[model samples]
Target: MAVKTIDDTENYTIEWDEEIGAIVFTWDKYVSGATFREGCEALLDAIKRRDAAKVLTDTRGINAHDAEDQQWMQTEWMPRALDVGLEYSAVVHPDSVISEMDVESILEGMEHSGAEPLVTSDMAEAREWTAEK
Candidate 1:
């Protein structure tokens, strides 16, 4: 299995995990504004180039999202991702209650369209869910 690092920054790391066959987003304690958008664009580029169908987001290290970023994720980023063939998604919930709520809201909005992500507290569970797809 070939694991490729697509994007690595102080805020996050996005990579292709060949074992699970998914693009993984490993976030830091806090990410917002331009950095968050850039990371999302990086993922989108990888998805297009690799023809990826799955994504696993590890939010365990992250805190809350800015309202604007959350809105951009639900409105702009997600649709673009789906258009580029992103199918299944799994998100490992953040430890903080505030961040968990933020992530959940985004997932709930996405449920109405596109791939509804599997949100879990356990990374193993999230990995398994994405790998199965």
Candidate 2:
């Protein structure tokens, strides 16, 4: 699989994985507000630019999310992502229980968006699940 870097920042990196035909978001530590929103938008643009439907989000390094950011993600970003043909997502959860719970809460609100989402602690599992047709 060819991995092309789309956007790289201190907080996160978004890439296009050609082999699996998925946009991958690899996060680093805590990110919030504008940084978080920008990263999400960049991921959406990557999906549209590559004409991809699946996404793999590696949140292993992330430790927390702002409440406002989480709300924005579920209410704003998610719908736009789905509108742009994001059909499936695999999230590699962070080790922090609080962060994991936050991720779960965000995912819960997205359940009705018609996208299949898999949450796991293992990167291999996430990759495998995201690549599925």
Candidate 3:
């Protein structure tokens, strides 16, 4: 397995980490609604192509997200992800309080999405947890 950068931009990078057999999305700055939608679509495509079941999402750089985007993630994306073999999701807690609140809001909807979710501020811990069956 080899690591591949799926999408890299000024705001974020979405990659496939072969070591963990997961798609990792790392935020480099606050993500606008359009950027967030683009990233999510790329992530879904990567997961399907790789048959990945785990995900590690690093949101520390994001300060906020649009309410409509959050709603889309919760109502549409999360369910679609679970349908496509997403079994575990490890979210790295954001440093910004506002971003953290957004994460919490998303998690509330994910509670019943059939994927196990873990919230942590440590990347290493997130990797370890996502790697576990």
lDDT of each: 0.83, 0.83, 0.81
Which candidate gets the maximum TM-score versus the true structure? 2
Please give, for residues 42-66, the per-residue lDDT of candidate 1 as tens digits.
8789889889999898888876788
lDDT of 3 by residue, 17-128 (tens): 8788788988787766777788788888878888888889998776667889889888888888888898888889766666667787876656676668888778888888
With candidate 1 superimposed using the best TM-score fit, by how many Å does residue 108's alpha carbon deviate from the native?
Answer: 2.6
Q: Pairs clashing in candidate 2?
A: none
Give residue 53's error in model 2 in angstroms: 0.6
**TM-score, predicted candidate 3 vs. hidden true structure:** 0.87
Predicted candidate 2 versus true structure: per-residue lDDT over 9-87, tens digit per residue: 8888998887777888988767789978888888888888888889999988876678999888888888888888888
